[model samples]
Target: MAFVQLLVTSLLILVTKADVAIDIENASSDVYWIGILANPGLPIPSNGGFVLNGGQTTTVSVPDNWVGRFWARTGCDSGTNTCQTGDCRNGVECAGNGGAPPVTLVEITIKGDGGQDFYDISLVDGFNVKASIQPIDGTGDCSTAECESDVNAACPEQLKDGDYACYSSCAKFNTDQYCCRNELNFHSLMIIISPRVPLKFQMITVV
Candidate 1:
Protein backbone atom coordinates (compact mmCIF):
# COMPACT_ATOMS: atom_id res chain seq x y z
CA MET A 1 0.00 0.00 0.00
CA ALA A 2 3.10 2.20 -0.11
CA PHE A 3 5.45 2.68 -3.07
CA VAL A 4 6.67 6.05 -4.35
CA GLN A 5 9.54 7.37 -6.47
CA LEU A 6 9.92 10.71 -8.23
CA LEU A 7 12.66 12.93 -9.71
CA VAL A 8 12.42 16.40 -11.19
CA THR A 9 15.06 18.87 -12.43
CA SER A 10 14.72 22.24 -14.03
CA LEU A 11 16.64 25.44 -14.86
CA LEU A 12 15.79 28.18 -17.31
CA ILE A 13 17.40 31.54 -16.83
CA LEU A 14 16.92 33.94 -19.71
CA VAL A 15 18.40 37.34 -19.23
CA THR A 16 20.94 36.59 -21.92
CA LYS A 17 24.04 37.76 -20.11
CA ALA A 18 25.57 34.46 -21.23
CA ASP A 19 25.48 31.43 -18.90
CA VAL A 20 23.73 28.14 -19.70
CA ALA A 21 24.51 24.78 -18.21
CA ILE A 22 21.92 22.04 -17.76
CA ASP A 23 22.50 18.37 -17.05
CA ILE A 24 19.97 15.75 -15.90
CA GLU A 25 19.80 11.98 -15.66
CA ASN A 26 17.89 9.02 -14.16
CA ALA A 27 15.39 8.62 -16.95
CA SER A 28 13.17 6.19 -15.08
CA SER A 29 13.00 3.20 -12.80
CA ASP A 30 10.39 5.01 -10.81
CA VAL A 31 12.67 7.89 -9.56
CA TYR A 32 12.57 7.20 -5.80
CA TRP A 33 11.60 10.73 -4.72
CA ILE A 34 12.56 14.41 -4.97
CA GLY A 35 11.27 17.95 -4.12
CA ILE A 36 12.21 21.46 -5.09
CA LEU A 37 9.44 24.02 -5.09
CA ALA A 38 10.29 27.76 -5.08
CA ASN A 39 7.25 29.28 -3.40
CA PRO A 40 4.28 28.37 -1.18
CA GLY A 41 6.14 29.68 1.87
CA LEU A 42 9.08 27.48 0.96
CA PRO A 43 10.72 24.98 3.38
CA ILE A 44 8.88 21.72 2.76
CA PRO A 45 10.53 18.66 4.19
CA SER A 46 9.11 16.46 6.91
CA ASN A 47 7.10 13.51 5.70
CA GLY A 48 9.82 11.38 7.08
CA GLY A 49 12.67 13.55 5.86
CA PHE A 50 15.70 12.34 3.84
CA VAL A 51 15.44 9.23 1.69
CA LEU A 52 17.14 8.18 -1.56
CA ASN A 53 18.76 4.93 -2.57
CA GLY A 54 21.49 5.97 -5.04
CA GLY A 55 22.62 8.41 -7.74
CA GLN A 56 21.30 11.85 -6.76
CA THR A 57 22.55 15.33 -7.49
CA THR A 58 20.94 18.74 -7.18
CA THR A 59 22.17 22.17 -8.28
CA VAL A 60 19.83 25.11 -8.61
CA SER A 61 20.50 28.77 -9.41
CA VAL A 62 18.44 30.29 -12.17
CA PRO A 63 19.10 33.96 -12.28
CA ASP A 64 17.98 36.17 -15.15
CA ASN A 65 14.30 36.56 -15.99
CA TRP A 66 13.10 33.36 -14.30
CA VAL A 67 10.94 30.20 -14.78
CA GLY A 68 11.16 27.08 -12.61
CA ARG A 69 9.02 24.36 -11.04
CA PHE A 70 10.57 21.39 -9.28
CA TRP A 71 8.86 18.74 -7.16
CA ALA A 72 9.29 15.26 -5.60
CA ARG A 73 7.40 12.98 -3.16
CA THR A 74 8.32 9.34 -2.92
CA GLY A 75 6.91 6.41 -0.87
CA CYS A 76 5.80 8.08 2.44
CA ASP A 77 6.77 6.31 5.60
CA SER A 78 9.74 6.91 7.89
CA GLY A 79 9.45 3.62 9.71
CA THR A 80 10.06 3.31 13.49
CA ASN A 81 6.29 3.22 13.81
CA THR A 82 5.34 6.72 14.84
CA CYS A 83 1.59 7.33 14.77
CA GLN A 84 -0.07 6.60 18.05
CA THR A 85 -3.69 6.97 19.10
CA GLY A 86 -4.93 4.81 21.88
CA ASP A 87 -7.73 2.89 20.19
CA CYS A 88 -8.69 5.98 18.26
CA ARG A 89 -8.65 7.98 21.48
CA ASN A 90 -10.46 11.26 22.05
CA GLY A 91 -13.59 9.43 20.91
CA VAL A 92 -13.02 5.71 21.03
CA GLU A 93 -14.60 3.38 18.44
CA CYS A 94 -12.75 0.11 17.98
CA ALA A 95 -14.13 -2.12 15.27
CA GLY A 96 -12.29 -4.74 13.16
CA ASN A 97 -8.59 -3.93 12.62
CA GLY A 98 -9.04 -1.11 15.09
CA GLY A 99 -10.94 0.96 12.50
CA ALA A 100 -8.18 1.03 9.90
CA PRO A 101 -7.77 4.36 8.07
CA PRO A 102 -4.23 5.60 8.50
CA VAL A 103 -1.49 4.39 6.20
CA THR A 104 0.06 7.75 5.26
CA LEU A 105 1.55 9.21 2.06
CA VAL A 106 -1.17 10.77 -0.02
CA GLU A 107 -0.84 14.44 -0.81
CA ILE A 108 0.75 15.29 -4.15
CA THR A 109 -0.03 18.06 -6.61
CA ILE A 110 2.75 19.30 -8.92
CA LYS A 111 1.94 20.74 -12.27
CA GLY A 112 4.90 21.54 -14.54
CA ASP A 113 6.19 24.76 -16.08
CA GLY A 114 9.54 26.53 -15.83
CA GLY A 115 8.97 26.42 -19.53
CA GLN A 116 6.02 24.11 -19.64
CA ASP A 117 6.32 21.72 -16.71
CA PHE A 118 4.40 18.43 -16.62
CA TYR A 119 3.66 16.05 -13.75
CA ASP A 120 0.10 15.76 -12.58
CA ILE A 121 -0.20 13.25 -9.76
CA SER A 122 -3.54 12.02 -8.44
CA LEU A 123 -4.79 9.64 -5.81
CA VAL A 124 -8.08 9.78 -3.94
CA ASP A 125 -9.99 6.79 -5.23
CA GLY A 126 -9.47 7.90 -8.85
CA PHE A 127 -6.00 6.34 -8.83
CA ASN A 128 -3.55 7.51 -11.48
CA VAL A 129 0.13 8.12 -10.73
CA LYS A 130 2.97 8.39 -13.18
CA ALA A 131 5.88 10.84 -12.92
CA SER A 132 9.15 10.85 -14.82
CA ILE A 133 11.27 13.68 -16.27
CA GLN A 134 14.74 13.55 -17.77
CA PRO A 135 15.98 16.56 -19.65
CA ILE A 136 18.39 19.11 -18.23
CA ASP A 137 19.59 22.37 -19.77
CA GLY A 138 20.61 25.65 -18.23
CA THR A 139 20.70 29.40 -19.08
CA GLY A 140 17.96 31.04 -21.10
CA ASP A 141 16.26 33.96 -19.39
CA CYS A 142 14.45 37.02 -20.73
CA SER A 143 10.70 36.80 -20.74
CA THR A 144 9.36 39.00 -18.02
CA ALA A 145 6.92 41.48 -19.39
CA GLU A 146 4.67 40.26 -16.56
CA CYS A 147 1.15 38.87 -16.87
CA GLU A 148 -0.53 37.09 -13.97
CA SER A 149 -3.93 35.57 -13.15
CA ASP A 150 -4.18 32.46 -10.97
CA VAL A 151 -6.49 33.45 -8.20
CA ASN A 152 -8.90 31.23 -6.26
CA ALA A 153 -9.75 32.20 -2.69
CA ALA A 154 -11.69 29.01 -1.99
CA CYS A 155 -14.50 28.54 0.59
CA PRO A 156 -17.59 26.73 -0.59
CA GLU A 157 -17.94 24.90 2.64
CA GLN A 158 -14.23 24.16 2.52
CA LEU A 159 -14.52 23.33 -1.17
CA LYS A 160 -14.89 19.96 -2.83
CA ASP A 161 -16.64 20.92 -6.03
CA GLY A 162 -13.56 20.78 -8.24
CA ASP A 163 -11.41 19.07 -5.68
CA TYR A 164 -7.90 20.44 -5.00
CA ALA A 165 -7.70 21.12 -1.35
CA CYS A 166 -4.83 22.58 0.66
CA TYR A 167 -5.52 24.69 3.72
CA SER A 168 -7.01 23.19 6.80
CA SER A 169 -5.35 23.17 10.19
CA CYS A 170 -7.16 25.82 12.09
CA ALA A 171 -8.66 26.81 8.77
CA LYS A 172 -8.47 30.40 7.49
CA PHE A 173 -8.32 30.96 3.74
CA ASN A 174 -11.96 30.57 2.96
CA THR A 175 -12.88 32.21 -0.33
CA ASP A 176 -11.40 35.59 0.51
CA GLN A 177 -10.12 34.97 -3.01
CA TYR A 178 -6.68 36.53 -3.52
CA CYS A 179 -3.72 34.19 -3.66
CA CYS A 180 -2.43 32.00 -6.48
CA ARG A 181 -0.14 34.08 -8.65
CA ASN A 182 2.50 31.32 -8.96
CA GLU A 183 4.85 33.22 -11.17
CA LEU A 184 7.96 34.85 -9.76
CA ASN A 185 10.65 34.64 -12.43
CA PHE A 186 14.17 33.14 -12.18
CA HIS A 187 14.36 29.33 -12.23
CA SER A 188 16.07 26.81 -9.90
CA LEU A 189 14.70 23.52 -8.45
CA MET A 190 16.28 20.26 -7.19
CA ILE A 191 14.58 17.70 -4.96
CA ILE A 192 15.34 14.25 -3.58
CA ILE A 193 13.50 12.02 -1.08
CA SER A 194 14.23 8.35 -1.41
CA PRO A 195 13.03 5.25 0.43
CA ARG A 196 15.50 2.40 0.05
CA VAL A 197 13.91 -0.66 -1.55
CA PRO A 198 15.92 -0.68 -4.75
CA LEU A 199 16.62 3.02 -5.34
CA LYS A 200 18.84 5.63 -3.65
CA PHE A 201 20.28 9.09 -4.38
CA GLN A 202 20.75 12.39 -2.55
CA MET A 203 22.80 15.54 -3.16
CA ILE A 204 21.78 19.17 -2.69
CA THR A 205 23.68 22.32 -3.68
CA VAL A 206 22.40 25.83 -4.30
CA VAL A 207 24.56 28.72 -5.52
Candidate 2:
Protein backbone atom coordinates (compact mmCIF):
# COMPACT_ATOMS: atom_id res chain seq x y z
CA MET A 1 0.00 0.00 0.00
CA ALA A 2 2.83 2.39 0.70
CA PHE A 3 4.32 1.85 -2.76
CA VAL A 4 0.99 2.50 -4.43
CA GLN A 5 0.54 5.79 -2.65
CA LEU A 6 4.06 6.88 -3.53
CA LEU A 7 3.52 6.05 -7.16
CA VAL A 8 0.36 8.11 -7.28
CA THR A 9 2.10 10.99 -5.59
CA SER A 10 4.93 10.96 -8.11
CA LEU A 11 2.48 11.07 -10.99
CA LEU A 12 0.69 13.98 -9.37
CA ILE A 13 3.92 15.94 -9.20
CA LEU A 14 4.66 15.29 -12.85
CA VAL A 15 1.23 16.56 -13.85
CA THR A 16 1.69 19.73 -11.85
CA LYS A 17 4.97 20.77 -13.44
CA ALA A 18 3.60 20.09 -16.94
CA ASP A 19 2.00 23.52 -17.30
CA VAL A 20 2.90 24.87 -20.73
CA ALA A 21 -0.17 24.99 -22.95
CA ILE A 22 -0.15 24.39 -26.72
CA ASP A 23 -3.28 26.10 -28.00
CA ILE A 24 -4.31 24.89 -31.47
CA GLU A 25 -6.91 26.24 -33.83
CA ASN A 26 -8.26 24.56 -36.95
CA ALA A 27 -9.02 27.47 -39.28
CA SER A 28 -10.08 25.33 -42.21
CA SER A 29 -13.17 23.22 -42.95
CA ASP A 30 -11.53 19.81 -42.89
CA VAL A 31 -10.79 17.57 -39.96
CA TYR A 32 -7.35 18.08 -38.49
CA TRP A 33 -5.04 16.32 -36.09
CA ILE A 34 -2.74 17.67 -33.38
CA GLY A 35 0.63 15.92 -33.72
CA ILE A 36 3.36 16.12 -31.07
CA LEU A 37 6.99 15.00 -31.19
CA ALA A 38 9.30 14.96 -28.20
CA ASN A 39 12.86 15.88 -29.00
CA PRO A 40 15.51 13.20 -28.58
CA GLY A 41 16.91 13.18 -25.04
CA LEU A 42 13.52 14.42 -23.77
CA PRO A 43 10.37 12.44 -23.23
CA ILE A 44 6.80 13.68 -23.52
CA PRO A 45 3.74 12.09 -21.98
CA SER A 46 3.57 8.50 -23.17
CA ASN A 47 0.27 9.19 -24.82
CA GLY A 48 0.31 12.52 -26.73
CA GLY A 49 -1.48 14.09 -29.72
CA PHE A 50 -5.19 14.13 -30.56
CA VAL A 51 -7.74 14.77 -33.25
CA LEU A 52 -9.66 17.98 -33.98
CA ASN A 53 -12.56 18.83 -36.23
CA GLY A 54 -12.64 21.89 -38.39
CA GLY A 55 -13.19 25.29 -36.77
CA GLN A 56 -12.28 23.92 -33.38
CA THR A 57 -9.65 24.89 -30.84
CA THR A 58 -7.96 22.73 -28.23
CA THR A 59 -5.04 22.76 -25.84
CA VAL A 60 -2.42 20.18 -24.91
CA SER A 61 -0.05 20.24 -21.96
CA VAL A 62 3.69 20.04 -22.23
CA PRO A 63 6.28 19.04 -19.68
CA ASP A 64 8.61 21.81 -18.57
CA ASN A 65 11.96 22.03 -20.35
CA TRP A 66 10.42 20.16 -23.24
CA VAL A 67 11.50 20.77 -26.82
CA GLY A 68 9.47 19.50 -29.74
CA ARG A 69 7.55 20.32 -32.89
CA PHE A 70 3.79 20.31 -33.60
CA TRP A 71 1.97 20.00 -36.88
CA ALA A 72 -1.47 19.38 -38.36
CA ARG A 73 -2.44 16.25 -40.29
CA THR A 74 -5.10 16.06 -42.95
CA GLY A 75 -6.84 13.50 -45.18
CA CYS A 76 -6.90 10.83 -42.56
CA ASP A 77 -8.89 7.65 -42.65
CA SER A 78 -9.85 6.90 -39.09
CA GLY A 79 -10.91 3.42 -40.14
CA THR A 80 -7.66 2.55 -41.92
CA ASN A 81 -5.43 4.78 -39.74
CA THR A 82 -3.75 6.44 -42.68
CA CYS A 83 -3.05 10.10 -43.37
CA GLN A 84 -2.32 11.99 -46.53
CA THR A 85 -0.12 14.58 -44.88
CA GLY A 86 1.92 14.49 -41.69
CA ASP A 87 1.42 10.81 -41.00
CA CYS A 88 3.61 9.56 -38.17
CA ARG A 89 2.66 5.93 -38.97
CA ASN A 90 0.55 5.63 -35.80
CA GLY A 91 -3.16 6.12 -35.44
CA VAL A 92 -3.06 9.04 -32.98
CA GLU A 93 0.07 9.50 -30.89
CA CYS A 94 3.25 10.13 -32.82
CA ALA A 95 5.23 7.85 -30.50
CA GLY A 96 8.31 10.10 -30.94
CA ASN A 97 8.10 9.92 -34.70
CA GLY A 98 7.82 13.11 -36.76
CA GLY A 99 5.15 14.12 -39.22
CA ALA A 100 5.87 13.75 -42.91
CA PRO A 101 7.16 16.80 -44.80
CA PRO A 102 5.16 19.38 -46.78
CA VAL A 103 3.52 20.11 -43.46
CA THR A 104 3.91 23.39 -41.58
CA LEU A 105 5.50 22.99 -38.18
CA VAL A 106 5.45 24.91 -34.92
CA GLU A 107 8.49 24.36 -32.72
CA ILE A 108 8.92 25.18 -29.04
CA THR A 109 11.71 25.08 -26.52
CA ILE A 110 10.78 25.60 -22.90
CA LYS A 111 13.26 26.81 -20.28
CA GLY A 112 16.08 26.63 -22.77
CA ASP A 113 18.78 28.89 -24.12
CA GLY A 114 19.58 31.16 -21.16
CA GLY A 115 16.55 29.91 -19.23
CA GLN A 116 13.93 31.18 -21.65
CA ASP A 117 11.19 29.54 -23.69
CA PHE A 118 11.56 29.96 -27.45
CA TYR A 119 8.79 29.27 -29.97
CA ASP A 120 8.27 29.86 -33.66
CA ILE A 121 6.03 28.86 -36.57
CA SER A 122 7.74 27.46 -39.66
CA LEU A 123 7.00 26.96 -43.34
CA VAL A 124 10.28 25.37 -44.31
CA ASP A 125 8.45 22.17 -45.22
CA GLY A 126 5.71 24.08 -46.99
CA PHE A 127 2.18 24.47 -45.58
CA ASN A 128 -1.21 22.82 -45.34
CA VAL A 129 -3.16 24.76 -42.71
CA LYS A 130 -2.92 27.91 -40.64
CA ALA A 131 -1.52 27.60 -37.10
CA SER A 132 -0.10 29.75 -34.30
CA ILE A 133 1.31 29.50 -30.78
CA GLN A 134 1.03 31.83 -27.77
CA PRO A 135 2.44 31.58 -24.27
CA ILE A 136 -0.56 32.09 -22.08
CA ASP A 137 -0.03 34.47 -19.13
CA GLY A 138 3.75 34.09 -19.39
CA THR A 139 6.54 36.64 -19.60
CA GLY A 140 9.64 37.43 -21.70
CA ASP A 141 8.77 37.93 -25.34
CA CYS A 142 5.76 35.63 -25.49
CA SER A 143 5.00 36.76 -28.96
CA THR A 144 2.29 35.19 -31.14
CA ALA A 145 3.59 33.23 -34.12
CA GLU A 146 1.12 32.54 -36.88
CA CYS A 147 0.61 31.69 -40.57
CA GLU A 148 -2.74 32.86 -41.94
CA SER A 149 -2.37 33.36 -45.65
CA ASP A 150 -3.19 30.26 -47.67
CA VAL A 151 -0.52 29.82 -50.32
CA ASN A 152 -2.29 26.80 -51.81
CA ALA A 153 -4.80 29.01 -53.53
CA ALA A 154 -2.13 30.00 -55.99
CA CYS A 155 -0.83 26.42 -56.32
CA PRO A 156 -0.87 25.16 -59.83
CA GLU A 157 -3.75 22.80 -60.55
CA GLN A 158 -1.26 20.01 -61.02
CA LEU A 159 -0.44 20.24 -57.32
CA LYS A 160 -3.70 21.36 -55.77
CA ASP A 161 -5.14 19.22 -53.00
CA GLY A 162 -8.80 19.53 -53.98
CA ASP A 163 -8.96 22.50 -51.57
CA TYR A 164 -7.19 20.65 -48.79
CA ALA A 165 -3.54 21.76 -49.07
CA CYS A 166 -0.80 22.94 -51.39
CA TYR A 167 2.05 20.48 -51.59
CA SER A 168 5.70 21.51 -51.48
CA SER A 169 7.18 22.33 -54.83
CA CYS A 170 9.63 19.47 -54.38
CA ALA A 171 6.81 17.01 -54.01
CA LYS A 172 5.65 17.92 -57.49
CA PHE A 173 8.73 19.16 -59.34
CA ASN A 174 11.76 17.81 -57.42
CA THR A 175 13.92 20.74 -58.52
CA ASP A 176 17.22 21.74 -57.00
CA GLN A 177 15.88 25.07 -55.76
CA TYR A 178 12.67 23.65 -54.32
CA CYS A 179 14.28 20.59 -52.75
CA CYS A 180 17.34 22.63 -51.62
CA ARG A 181 19.62 20.15 -53.42
CA ASN A 182 22.70 20.80 -55.51
CA GLU A 183 22.38 21.00 -59.28
CA LEU A 184 24.81 19.62 -61.93
CA ASN A 185 26.19 17.25 -59.26
CA PHE A 186 28.42 19.99 -57.78
CA HIS A 187 26.48 23.29 -57.52
CA SER A 188 24.29 24.44 -54.64
CA LEU A 189 21.28 26.60 -55.46
CA MET A 190 20.76 29.65 -53.30
CA ILE A 191 17.41 29.65 -51.48
CA ILE A 192 15.72 32.93 -52.32
CA ILE A 193 11.99 32.34 -52.31
CA SER A 194 10.32 34.69 -49.83
CA PRO A 195 7.43 33.82 -47.56
CA ARG A 196 5.31 35.39 -50.21
CA VAL A 197 5.93 35.24 -53.96
CA PRO A 198 4.50 37.43 -56.71
CA LEU A 199 1.95 36.44 -59.37
CA LYS A 200 4.25 37.51 -62.18
CA PHE A 201 5.45 34.55 -64.23
CA GLN A 202 8.79 32.83 -63.68
CA MET A 203 10.24 29.59 -64.98
CA ILE A 204 12.32 26.76 -63.51
CA THR A 205 13.61 23.58 -65.17
CA VAL A 206 15.00 20.73 -63.08
CA VAL A 207 17.23 19.19 -65.74
Report the number of the highest-TM-score candidate: 2
Over 50-118, each residue of candidate 1 has an lDDT whose tens digit, in order, gives: 222335443233332222332223333335322121111112111111111111112222222344322
- Looking at candidate 2, the ten consecutive residues that score lowest on lDDT are 1-10
Runs of candidate 2 with Cα error greater than 4 angstroms are 1-18, 23-29, 46-48, 55-59, 156-163, 168-207
TM-score of candidate 1 against the unseen true structure = 0.19
Superposed model 1: Cα runs more than 4 Å off = 1-18, 22-55, 58-64, 76-174, 177-207
| Model 2: per-residue Cα lDDT over 1-207, one tens digit each | 000000000010111124654445565567766677877777655355678776666656666777877777888888988688778888877777777766767666667779776666665566676565555556566556565556566666766666766656666577766666555434443432343644221222210
What is the alpha-carbon lDDT for the whole of candidate 2? 0.58
